[model samples]
Target: MALRLAQILPPVVLLVLAIVGILLVVLPARETTKTPENMYGIVLDAGSSHTAMYIYKWPSDKQNGTGIVTQHSECKVKGRGISSYAGIRGEAAKSLEACMQEALSQIPKSRQAQTILCLGATAGMRLLDIVNSTESRRVMKEVETKLRSYPFKFKEAVILSGQAEGAYGWVTVNYLLENFVRYGFVGKWLNSGRETIGALDLGGASTQITFETAEKVEDESNLKELKLYGQTYKLYTQSFLCYGQDQFLRKLLAHLIKTQGVKSPIFHPCYPRQFNTTIKLGQDVFNSPCTKSYRPAKFDPYMNVTVVGTGDGGECLASVKKMFSFDNCTYSKCSFDGVFQPTVKGGFMAFSAFYINYNYLTRLTNISIRSSNQMANAMRLVCNMSMTEMVEKTNQMERYLKNVCAVSHFVKILLTEGYVFDEDAFPTISFQKKAGGASVGWALGYMLTMSNLVPAESLGLMKAMPSGTWTAILTLFILLLFFALGYMLLIYRARTKQDLV
Candidate 1:
C-alpha cells in the first residue's frame, strides 16, 4: 500500500511543480502588458500653408510603438491665414473650425486616439509676434478654443517653437531617407564614418540650414540623437526668417544687379520682369511696353534668382558646395539639399530635389521636341530604343507623370546628379515670408517615445530577469527533488498496505 501511494504521489507532485515553474516564467509577461491607463496621442503639423495630423493608439505593439505610423491624414483651410498671429481672422476662426472638422472626419470613430498636439511654422508664429496686439492674441485664443470642441477626445493644443519645428523636419527627413528601401539605409548611413550631414530646408516662409552630427543610436528605435550643427538639438537651429519665395527673389535680384550691372537690359519679358510686373520700367517702356500689358509685378529682389544651367546656377551651386567642401559624400559629389516652394494658402508644397537645380524643372515646364529626340538618342547609346517612337511615348509619359504626380523634376535630379543642363543658364529667383513658432509640449509629446528619450524594453519572449532569481529557481528545483522523494516513500507505504490487505 505504501509503495503504490508513493508512486502516484510522486507523479502528481512532479506535475504540480512543472506547472508552477511555467507560471513563474509567464507571469511577468502578463504584467508587462498593463499599459499606462487610457492615454492616446495625436500630432498636428500646421505649416504655413496646410495642417497635417498623425494619430497614435496606446498599448502599442511592443514590436512597433504607436507614435508615428503611416496611418494619418491632412487637411487645408482655405480662408485661414497661415500666420500664427493673424491667419485666424473673424471668418478665419470658422474656416479653421471647418477645416479641423474635416480633418477629424477622416479619422475613424472606432479609434480612441486622444492627446492632440499642434505645430505651426513661419506664417502662424510670425503673425503672433508681428501682430502682438490684443486683437491678435484674442483671435489665437479663439482658434484654440474652437479646435477643442471636436467630437473626439481632446488634449491641449501646443504651438511648437521654431527650433522645434526645424528639428521635427530634420528628424522626419532623416527618418525617411534612413529608411529608403534600397539603401539598406539605417544600417549603412548610421554606421558609416560620416559624422554629419548638411540639412538645407528651403521652405515657403523661412529657409533653414542645419549642420547636424549624428550623436548616438538608441535601442533600434525610430528616433536617433543628433547634435545640432549650431548649438542645441531642439532650439539651437538657426533660421533666417522670411527667406522663402518673395524674400529669396529680392535677394537674387540685388545680387544680379550688383554682379552683372544688367538691370533693365533684359532681352525678353520672361528674363527679369516675369515674376513681378508691378515694378515701373521708366515712362517710354511703361506707356508702350514690349507687349500689350505692362502691369507692375510685386518683386522680392533679395531672392537668389540664379537659375540652374545658368551662370548663376553655377554660382549658387558653388556657394552651397563651398559650405560643405571640407567633407566628401559617398553617394555623389553634391551635398544633400532641397528646395520647398509652397503656393499661397498652402494649396500645394512642391519639394524640389535637394541641391537646387533649375534646368530639371525648366525642362519639364518647357521641354521641346528636339530635346525629346535627344533624350531618345542618349538612351540608344546604352539600350535598344526606337528614337522617334520612344521619344513620343516618353514625352507623353513625362507629361502624364508630371501632371499627375509632379515628380518628373525630382526624378531627373536624382538620375542626372544635381540639375540637368544644356549649357550655362541664369538661376531664377523667388522668396517667401516667414512666421514661425514651435511648442515644447508638442515636442515632448511627439518625441516622447523616441528611443533616445526612453529606455528599451525586453522585446521577445525573454523578459527582464529578477536579480538572484536564478538562485531561487535552483533552490525550488532542489526542494522539488526532496518532495518527490517523500512522495515516493508515501506511495511505497500505500502499496505495502494494499499488499497486506
Candidate 2:
C-alpha cells in the first residue's frame, strides 16, 4: 500500500506542476489582452469672450510616462465669460450650469466621482482681478461652489497666471503634435526625438507665445522649464495682456476715436468703405483697462458716436503698427511692447483668433497666407471688399463680417511685427483651430499637470520577464511535467504488474 501511494503521489505532483505552469503563462497573457478601464477629466476654460468646457479621457494604464489623453466631448457655455457676470452675484457660477449638466451625460455615472474637474479663468479674470480683486474673489468662490455641487471630484477654481497659461498652451500644442513621446512601430512607447513646435495663442484678452529655446532668455520671468515624457525642455514664453483680438480691437477703436477726435462720422481706415456702426464712448470703447488711457476727458459715458469705414488698407496697417511699441527693448531681443523673447525658432501652431481671421481671409479672397506678401495681398483684398460684397461672399453675419478686415490686419501685424516672424519665418506659422481632434488651448495641459496624469517616469511592466520568454519557459516546464508524469505512471503500472505477477 505504501508503494502504491508513492507511485500515485509522484504522478499527481507532476500533473499539479504542469497545471500551475500553464496558468502562470496563460493568466498574464489574458490580462494583457483585456482592455484597461478608462479615466475621465473635465476642464472648463473661462475666457473673456465666452466659456467652454472640455471633457478628456485616457486609459487607466498609461503608456510610457504620459496618459494618452484625448478630448472626449466639449460644451460652450451660453452667454459671456464668468467675469462678465461680475457685480451680479451667483450669475458667474450659474453660467457654467448648462455645460456642467452636459458633462453629466458625457461621463459615466460610475466614474463621475473618480473623475477630476477643474476650472481655469484666463486673461479676462486676470484683468478683473487687477481691476477689482473683490469681484474676482467673489466670482471664483461662486464658481467653486457651483463645481462642488456636481458629482465630479472638484480640483480647484483659480485664475491661471500668464506664465502658467503660456507654458501649458505650449504643452498642449506639442502633446497633440506627438512631439514628446509616440508609440513606435516596435510595439513600444518611444521618445519621439522630434523638434518641438512653438505655440501662438490669440484669445479675446491676451496673446501667448511659447517655444523651446536653447538661447539664454533675457527675462527670467519669461523663461519656463518643463519635464514631459521623461524629456526636459527649456521654453521661452510671454503673454501680452490686453493684446488679444477683442482687446486689441478695443484699443484700435479707442485710438481711432482719440486720434480723429470723438465726433459723429469718425473715419476708420480698417473698416470696409460702406460699413458704419454706432458705439458709445465710455461703455463700448473705454470700459476696459486696456482702453482706459485713451478715454476722453469730457465725453459722456452714454454718448453715441458714429464710426464710418474708409477702406484704406495701407492706413489700416499703419494704424495697427502704432498700437505696438517696438523701440524700448531692454533685452537682447524683443517681440513687441518691449517684452523679451528668443528668436522665433521652429514651426508654430497659431490658434484661436489667429486661425479665425486666417480662415475668414482665405475664404473671402481664396488666398493662402504663406508669406508676408501673401498676407498683405489677402488683407488688401479683404479690406477693399464692400459690406454687401463681404456679406454675399462670406455668408456670415454683418457684425462679424464688418470686423474681418481689421482683425485680419491685426493678426498680420501681430505676427510679422509683434512676434518678429519675418518673411522666411512667416510660412512656418500654421493657423489651426484644433489638433489631434482636440481644440488647441491651455486647458488640457493644465488638467494634465494638476491631475498628475503625466508622470516623470515611464510605468514599469508588471512582470520582470518578457511575455515571449515567459511563454517559452512555461511551455518547456509543462512538456517536462507531462513526460515526467507519463514516465511515473508507466513505472507505477509496471511495478503493479510485477507485484501482481
Candidate 3:
C-alpha cells in the first residue's frame, strides 16, 4: 500500500508540474505581446509658387525602412511661397502660421512632443540664393524661428539641393506607388516588379528628372547612387535650373525684350489676340541668370511694354522653340543645354505645373491635341483666341485667363524638344498630384529620411537576435521539455509500481 501511494503521488506531481510550466510559457507571451502605439511627424514643402505642409503618422516601434509612414494630412500656407517674402523678411515666417496651426489641430497633445517637424525649400529658394543671397539666409532664419516657436519637435529648415530633390522625389513616387522591394516576417517579401518609374518635377523655378538605370550612364556626375530601404540604386538625374514654366517665361520675356525693345509694343503669340496688358520689364527680367549672360546687357530701369495678343499658334510654337538650345552634346545623350541624361526609362510621373496645364488640354478646351504632333495645335488653339473668347470659353478670372498659350506650349516643347521624350513614349508618363490617396511629391520622402525612417542598415543584419517567431519557438521548446520530463517521471513511477507488485 505504501509503494502504491508513492507511485500515484509521484506521477500526479509530475503531471501538475508539466501543466504549470505550460501555463507559464503561454500566459506570459499573451500578456507581453503589446501593440506599439502610433507616432506622428510633419513636413513642409516651400516651393517657388506656394508653401504646403504635410502631416505623417506611423507606429512608434517600426522605424525600419519606409517604416509604414504615410502622409496623414496636408495644409497649404495662407500666402505664396517663402521665397515670395524675400522683400519683407518678416512676412516669410508669418506665412507658415496658418499651416502650423492646422498641424497642431490634426495631431493629439500626447504625441506632440514626440512628433518631428521639418521644412524643405525647393527651386524658389535656390533662385533666391542666386538673385539675393543675403535675403535668402535672413528669410530662412526667420522661418526657422517661427517653426521652433511651435509645440512639436522642430528638426530643421533648409534649402534642398537639386540632387537631393531629384533623388528624394524618385523615392516619394516609388514609395507612394509601392514600387519597392519589401522584406519582413509578417508576410513574404514582395518585390515591386522589375524597376521603379522615373520622376519629373516641374516646379515654378526649376525642373528635375530622375530614373533608375542599368545601362552605362553617359555622364557620371548626373548619376546618383543612393542606399535607401537597405537597398542600393544608381539613378540618372538632372535639374534644369531656370527651365521651369515661370523661369522660362521670364527668359522668353527677356528674349522678346532684347529683340523688341520695351519702348515698342510687342505682339506675343503666347497671349490672346484681344488681350492687352502693360508690364514693366526691369533689369531684373534681363539680368536673371537664365537670360543675362546669353543676351546683351540692358538698363536696370523699369521699361514699360504693352503686351498685345496676336493669335497665331504656329508663330507661338516657333517662339517657344528658341528658349531651348539643343545644340551642344558632351554625353552620349543629353536632355537640353548640354545636360547629360540617359534614355528616359520605365514610366514617369509628370507633376506640379505639368499636370495643372496639360491635364485639361483636350477636355476643357474642346480641343484634341492628345498627340505630340498636336503640340503646336494646342498652342495654336490658345494663341489664336481673343481675350473675350478665352474669358467666355473658360469662365475664369483675367489673371487665370492669361498665360494659357505660354503654359500649354511650354509643356509641349519641354516634353518634345527639351527632354527628347518622343511621341511614342507619351503613354509611359502620368500627370498626377497624388497616388494611392497621398500627395505625390518629395516632401514625404524628405521627412522620412530626416526622421531616420529610411534606415541605412539591413533589418535582418541589425537584429541582435531573432524576434517574433524565434521568441515563440523558444517558448515552445521550454513547454515541450516540461512535457518530456513529466512523461519520464510517469514511466519511472509505473515501473516502480510493477516492481513492487
Candidate 4:
C-alpha cells in the first residue's frame, strides 16, 4: 500500500507543478503585495498663464500598469508663468520657490531624493523662444537653477515640442480614462478602430490638436507613433503657433494697426459694444513671430484702442474666420492652413486657455453647452454684457475676460472649420481642467514616459511580476520538485522490498 501510494504521489506532484507554471503564464495579474508600498513622482506644468506642480502617488509594485498612479496633490505657483520673467530675469526661478517648498512639505522626507522634478514649459516658452531665443534661454536656465535647489532628483527643464504637447495630452486623458488597459483587452478579441478620445490644448502662444485614426497621414511631420499600455497607435498632431488666444489677439491687433493708427481710437468687433481699452503697439505686439515683418507705419511704442463690440454672432464668427486659411492644404483633406487631419472622430477633451467651459463661467449660472449654437449663444450673452455687468457676473476679469466674444467665436471656427467637427459634436467635447484628481494636461504623460511605464516589448500579463511574487513562485517550484523526487525514491525502495519477499 505504501509503495503504491508513493508511486502515485510522484506523478501528482509533477502535474501540480505543470499546472501552476501554466497558470502563472496565462492568468491576469493582480497586486503582488497586499501591504501597500507607495512611491512618489512630481511634474511641473509651466504654462503661459502660470505654473502648476502635480504630486502623484502609486503602489511601487505596479508602476507599469494603468490606473495605478493617483494625483496626491497640486500646488499652483503664486505668480505668472516662467516665460513672463524673460525680460526681467531671475524671477522665473524665484517663482518656483514657494511651490517647491510646498512639495517638500507634502512628500515624506525619505522619498524626496528618489522623487523626480521636471519643468516642461509650453506655448509661452515656445513663443518666447521665437521672440528672443536668448531671453528664452535665460528663463529656462533660471528655472532650472531653482528646480535643482530642491532635494528631488532634477531631470529636465526644457521647452516641450508641439508634437509632445499634443501626443502627451492625449495620453494623459486616455490614461486617466483607463483607455490603455481597455485597448489592450479589446485588442485581443476585436479588429476595430482606436477608441481613444482626441486632445486639444490652447495656450497663450499656440494651439495643439491630436487624435488617433485609421486614415493615412500623408504629411509625415503631422503623424506620431506612440506605444502605451501595450498597444500601438498612430496619432495625428499639429501645433498652430501664433494661433493661441494671446497670439491670435496679437495678429488681430497687427491687422488693426494696418487700418487704424495710435492717434485714432480703434473700434473692434470682439469686445462689448461699449467696451473701451487702450492697447500699446509696443515691440511686445509686433516683435512676435506672429507679427513677423508686418509692421504698420502707424506702429508706435504706444497705441490706444477702443473696441466697439458687435454682439452679432454672425459678424463675430466671420471676423474670427479670417485668422484661418482654408485653401492651402496639400493633403487629401485639410482643416484650414493645409494641416492634415482625419475626420474628427470620438469625443474631444480641450484644456488650457480655450478649454471647454464645463466647470468655468460659474458666475454665468449652470450653463452646460452641448452644441455649437449653445456655445455661441452663451458667449454672446456674456460678450454683450457691459464691462460693469460682466465684472459683477464673473467677479473679475480673467486674462481673457475682455475678449469673451472673440474667444467663443474663435472656439467655433477652430473646432468646426479648423478641425471639422460638426455643431452637434461639441457635446462630446468635454472641457475640463482635471481628471482623477490630477491636472488634465501633459505633465502626467511626461512623467509616465520618463519613468518607463510602458515597456518596449509586451509581457503576457501587464509586464513582469514583482519580486515578492516571483519568490513565492520559486518556492512552490522547489517544494514540488522535492516531493516528486522523494516519492519516486520511496516507490523504488518499496518495489525492491516486495521483490525480495
Model 3 agreement with the true structure over 331-391: per-residue lDDT tens digits: 7877788887777777999887887776546544675544676655665666666777777
> On residues 189-278, what C-alpha lDDT tens digit does candidate 2 reach at each position?
567779999999999999999999999998899888887656779999889999988899999999998898888888999889968899
Q: Among these predicted structures, which one has the highest TM-score?
A: 2
lDDT of 1 by residue, 282-306 (tens): 3212222111122244333332222
Q: Which stretches of candidate 1 lie over 4 Å from their true place?
A: 1-42, 49-68, 79-81, 84-88, 110-115, 131-136, 152-159, 177-198, 214-236, 250-276, 279-501
Quote model 4's TM-score. 0.79
The predicted structure with the larger lDDT, 1 or 2, is 2
Model 4 clash pairs? Answer: 329-338, 356-431
Each prediction's total of clashing residue pairs, residues at least 3 apart in sequence or on different chains, is: 79, 0, 1, 2
Ranking by TM-score: 2, 3, 4, 1
**Candidate 2 ranges with C-alpha deviation above 4 Å:** 1-32, 63-65, 459-501
Q: Is candidate 2 or candidate 4 better by lDDT?
A: 2
Each prediction's whole-model lDDT (CA)? 0.36, 0.85, 0.76, 0.73
lDDT (Cα, 0-100) at 298 in candidate 2: 82
lDDT of 4 by residue, 243-284 (tens): 888778877766655655554566677776666666566744
Off by over 4 Å in 3: 1-37, 63-66, 182-189, 283-287, 294-300, 366-370, 374-376, 456-501
